[model samples]
Target: MTAATVLVVALGEVRSPVLESVTLARTLGTPVLLSLQPLSEADTDALGRAGVARALVADLGEARHAPAVAGRAVATAAEATGATVVLLPTSFVAKEAAAHAAFLLDAGLLVDVATLRLESGELVGGKRVFAGTWETECAVTSPVAVATVRANAIVAADAPEAVTTAVEPLSVDATLPRGLVLDEHEEHPRAEGRPALAEAAVVVAGGRGTEGDFAAVEELADALGAAIGTTRDCVDEGWQPHDAQIGQTGVTIAPRLYIGAGISGAPHHHGGMQASGTIVAVNVDPDAPLVQIADLAVIGDLQEILPAAAQAIREHRES
Candidate 1:
């Protein structure tokens, strides 16, 4: 049978990729239901803007941080709405939740899918594999499909007309698994005036060549309104935070534009960013691996090149 209904699961704090998933769901020609934990008025407004007609709001209380709990809630919503496909944004928590939801529903799971389509009444997904060296398509054979979609997979669009979403409260019986307890939790303050690294359209990253100095990289990132990322070496050297590190061991990004400075493009690092729409490499070494694979290679000291590029961008914007 064709996909009759689609479910898009997101956190209480709406993310851009969640909206993009909603936009993608609309194209499936199915009834789309949003599942949010601790829904808020802002979320409802955003849903209306995204053209969502219904939402399943769950109040997970203290168990909100538990992926299993979230996953159970998602499964319940999918069952209640008769959703054949469940879509979520790719994140650490979302990945775990998707896996758990798929297990509960006995559905096929796809992670970090770059594109999705309906073919012959089946959900098909395209993804890169083997460290982004090869592309492959996967079709879900189960009755239900759960997929965690990557960022920049689809551009978010606003609806042609406004919609008032009908909100429904979902009750989840699932709780924290046995022997697992959340004693305390701490929320970190987010960096201001910059977009989230995982969701940024443009990313400016530095590496060992920065010499523990990220001033130039920061300036260039700010000039282009881009997020700042760093290689594992930079994070290990304390030049950047662990959250800023992009690699197999850290976060994977698929920004529209990625600029690498002083990076050697190790396989681990390449796996994280190889899906970027365009890559530009700036390094002093003419034969750096990043330069070799970059769409544009600039041979120069990043300290000099970055500042000059930032200056040019600022000047052009003012002119």
Candidate 2:
């Protein structure tokens, strides 16, 4: 008999891609869950709705601190369950953690899997390579394959259906490594309201076309109830905060809607937001590379266009 396949999912602040993975997992066999924390009743209900077993334990606790140590413990727990495939969010920490775990378990690591499937009795996944320019399919059958999935790329469904799912909570004893805490800063109260380009559903970004005028960028974002972003030039000019910038060196966003104002539509910039569902660029040059990629291109100065567009959206939403 062949080894039964299992996909272990880690819970993080990022939305789970359970639906997509579960659909893909069905093409293989039973997909059981390996949770890190003791799930609450609500979490249990969610897992039950998805028709999967819940194996809860205190995860590595890397969200707050201790990533390296947590990696070993998490990897040990995963190996103990004999999970064939491990799915996790694709973050800097998650990637490092997954890499460390796979190293410990002596498995192959497939970072940032955009798609997954069973091919020729092996697991095949689509990965974004070379800053999203090249897409390649990778397959692994190294006893257990570790993968980190990108958020917003797939819908998650933890609906429990079959009652035969064996719910098992895990317990492991591991030594806590000494960590250096240089400083502890107080949490901001209005942090949730802060415009985060990575997590923003919609992002309105400006570039050199703004020429130091970011007032309209913020205005447009507020009108649309979206987050504001900027290009390298804009950030360099001190027109906007570095945190709101989106480019090769800045935050990457895959928002549902991306509005580019006065941006030259540089390829480097496009690399950051190419995953956006709908792209709209407003530029006077009219022949920028992004113009071809944009769903709608407006040939006009951004200063005037931004305000008018913001007003129009505000009116439309109010109506």
Candidate 3:
């Protein structure tokens, strides 16, 4: 059999799955055509240079998601391109889309793929499940497979010999589910300048240990220009928004640096961040679970420690 074609589900964001997909695409072969939803011209241009030969842009009008539509369309496109494997970003929406497409094509579905290898005759993928403790290998039974890769799991390695390919624009029509209205999208003002919470190099997170005051958390995050995240307790107790939660039920992130303040570091909470490169904790209770996993554990109230740390970081940055 000839080299298998890989269809990558792209995020189309300014700095995300666009680079991620293209990198993996080059690893598979030369022709890495990107399928985009909606993004700026600048983003498209940048992606174009990243070895994306084609852009199969699907129009969904003003509706935020047309999953069924995109899923079917991507599956059809993949089949036509003779693709043997489909890859998607492991985000909430991309996960749903890839699974749906795999079902439509009767292909195997693999989630949370961390590492991939194109062997002599077969493709192998590595997965870390159950809060980064167990390492699992996934080898599909079907010829056509669908997999979603965890963010930051792979480096973007592009080849200089990549060339653009022709695009066969795909379109779809379907009725969406009820009460799923995307009336308007207020772009996160910070999205343009600040790093995304999931993509941040440094993340500052707070938990129930902070009690009700997140002032220190905010100050520290501001000083570091880091996105603020939180544990489930902070969300459940109404001290923080649900978006801030980081756990099995919340967002999973693999940032370079993660700082925990007033967070007890439950296993469920750590599950979302155990993949982080560096972990620091500041908790009054020395017995918190975070202390065990933390590279640096400080036994002090976050309220006092955070301000001092923030000042130190600021001073270092200035110097």
Q: Largest lDDT belongs to which candidate?
A: 1
Ranking by lDDT: 1, 3, 2
Off by over 4 Å in 2: 1-8, 14-52, 59-64, 157-169, 172-196, 199-201, 211-215, 219-225, 310-319
**lDDT by residue for model 1 over 55-145, one digit each (tens)?**
8878787676678888888889889889989999888888998998999999999999988889998899999987778999999988899
lDDT of each: 0.87, 0.68, 0.74
Regions more than 4 Å wrong, model 1: 31-33, 184-187
Query: Against the hidden reference, what TM-scores do the models get?
Result: 0.95, 0.77, 0.85
Better of 2 and 3 by lDDT: 3
Clashes of each: 0, 13, 0
Shift in Å, residue 6, candidate 2: 4.3
Models, CA RMSD each: 1.6, 4.1, 3.2
Clashing pairs in 1: none
Error of 2 at 201 (Å): 4.3
User: Total backbone clashes of model 2?
Assistant: 13
lDDT of 3 by residue, 1-319 (tens): 1235777766445466447755775676543453555556665566566766666655555442556655776687677677877788777777787877898888878887877766755567888877888889977767677788777776665456554444556665544657655555544445234466766767899988888898998888888888889988878888877777788998888877899988888888999999887899998888889988999999998889999999998999999
Cα shift from native, residue 184, model 2 (Å): 6.2
By TM-score, the best candidate is: 1
TM-score leaderboard ranking:
1, 3, 2
Clashing pairs in 3: none
